[model samples]
Target: MNKLTAVAVSVLLLSAAPAQAQSIPGWKAYRAQQTGQQAAPAANAGQAPAAPPQATDPQPAALPQPAYQTAAAPYATRPAPKPAPNGGLFVGVQGGSGWVYEDVDQRAVAVSAGYRWQAGDYSQVGIELGAGRLDETTWRDYGIPEVKFNTIGANARFNFGNSPWFGVARLGYWHARSRDGWDRKVTADGAYGSLGVGVDLGRHFNLQLMYTGYTYAVDSYYGDDEYDINRADTVTLGAEVRF
Candidate 1:
């Protein structure tokens, strides 16, 4: 009986040794790790899930475009008097009617050419040469059949503020020749002066109203008496072009 009791006690001690190992610090954790490895799926197990395909370094995004552009737009209409050329060569013409020393109504036409330099922000100074013809005139009741005048002069022009309107003045030496109905010709030389106002068009053309006066002293003797034709006054509409 003693031997049998000793055998039974040894078998109960071996069984209790395993139960006490489960109460040890890491025995239950070790068993659960072994069971989870055996229960995992065959295809994805222990391969770290292929590292989630490594994310391929993610493609960069494209930059966005600007909202506004810098190109200029087309105009609906063109502007006038667009800041005329500062200095250049010019040509001009004039036509009108006038009186010769208050005695004759004469028709007249003239032309001029000059070179101008800019004198200020809105002004110019220049010299011009001009020639004109007069018709249907009576000189001191002499019934002159023809007359002609020529001049060499300097001129100044001014624009009013910012407008297209402008004023001009000129003065110079003048020479005149007249022929009577009897074909008797007399020549005189003196000074001429002119004043004018005008509008500038498209920076290159001008239209104006002008008044000019020519005063001449003649050194001619008619029947042993000396005669002088004082002056001729003319009003003209004029046009000019500049380059």
Candidate 2:
């Protein structure tokens, strides 16, 4: 009986020892789980890795343009003036000295208006009307009368070239009358011609330098005996305006 009880107790103790060991965690099993290799998911385990995305050509972007450009032209050219269907109207002013040929020197100022039609590749034909004053004319043709003069004229002009630098020619008829300050009245009728050059300031403005010569027949001055002919010349600087 004693031997059987001891055997039974031994078996119970041995079974309890296994249960306690299972309840306690082992350090070696913990370390193995931390350091061990992991398995891949079952779904992708057999497939080859996806090939890297195939490269495609990139699109081009617009190139930058230069800010400056080169000119192939050797010379500068003038721009054409505006012309109307009927004709173009223009106005001008001139101021300079006028001398009665073989007589006295005088200061002069003139204003003019004109109409022009294009006549050629680079020239314009025009009719002009103008009026002006001369400051003094000390001598009559016979050197007897002291006078200042007023002048009125109708003219024809030819402007050559569409360039900034250009040439001009004019022919005109003039009438001159002595001003009231003079002691006696005098009158002269004449024809005049001029040659000039001009620069274009811009589209509507121009500057000019001119030389003009006049020849007159004295209709009468105080009395007919004073003179039969009168002559004068002037150099003028002026401006022309067009619309």
Candidate 3:
């Protein structure tokens, strides 16, 4: 019976030795890991909660800009327009009636030549020379002779805006030579004036109606006045050509 008891005690000692060795190192590591995990939770609880991610508004995309171009300037300057020709030589002819005293009238004819140049956009200035003849007339009981006249003058013309019509004026010196009845010669000298209106017929031709006036003096055989002075006036229709 003593041998049996000893054998049982040895078996129990052997089993308890393995259990004690494992607990010495492995059990301590496991206990420390559990203590660290529990302390981390307690430390975080003392601080404020972390802020959630802030919501940011989305920005719009930028648009592309357009490029602009400037206009180019002209390289050359333009020239001015030229003016029309406003100077020329001219010739004219006229025929109409003449008057001397009361109820005394006769046929008359004339020719003229001149040169004109521009004075303004609406006017021209010139000089003219002319000659004319008046047919014979009977004065009361005395038979008067034919008359002839020569003239030199200054002349002016005016245009009515842009129309084809114009006005003319002339003032001049005149001389008259003729023969009276009974083979007697007569002579006179005086000033003459003329005015007319005209229209252009083409580039170089024109037509006009004109009136001219002058006075002549003749010695009288029976009269209170020193000389017999008579007015000689004519109305003529004329045409002219210009160069």
Top model number, lDDT: 3
As a whole number from 0 to 100, the lDDT of residue 222 in candidate 3 is 90
| Maximum-TM-score candidate | 3
| Reference-based TM-score of each model | 0.60, 0.54, 0.61
Candidate 1 residue-wise lDDT, 1-243, digit = tens: 699999999999999999999998799999999888877776566676555555578678966654333333444345554455456888999999877746467888999989889887789899999999887665566664667888999977888866889998999998888865578887889899999999988678999899998888765566546766687889999999989
Ranking by TM-score: 3, 1, 2
| Higher-lDDT candidate of 2 and 3 | 3
Error of 1 at 98 (Å): 2.0
Candidate 2 clash figure, as a count: 0
Candidate 2: tens digits of C-alpha lDDT, residues 1-243: 699999999999999997877666895576566555343445457898889999998989867765444553556576777432223688999999888645467787888888777665556677888777776545555333323434344433444444466677778787777734445676777788888888878767888899988888764557867657768888899998987
Off-target runs (Cα >4 Å) in candidate 3 are 1-85, 138-142, 220-225
Q: Please list the C-alpha lDDT of all candidates, in the order they appear.
A: 0.82, 0.70, 0.85
Query: Candidates ranked by lDDT, best first?
Result: 3, 1, 2
All candidates: CA RMSD in angstroms? 12.1, 8.7, 16.5
**What C-alpha lDDT, on a 0 to 100 scale, does residue 139 get in candidate 2?**
55
Q: What are the per-residue Cα lDDT tens digits for candidate 3 across 159-201?
A: 7876778898999998999886666788988889999999988
lDDT value, candidate 3, whole model: 0.85
- Better-scoring candidate (TM-score), 1 or 3: 3
Q: Residue 71 CA error for candidate 2 (Å)?
A: 18
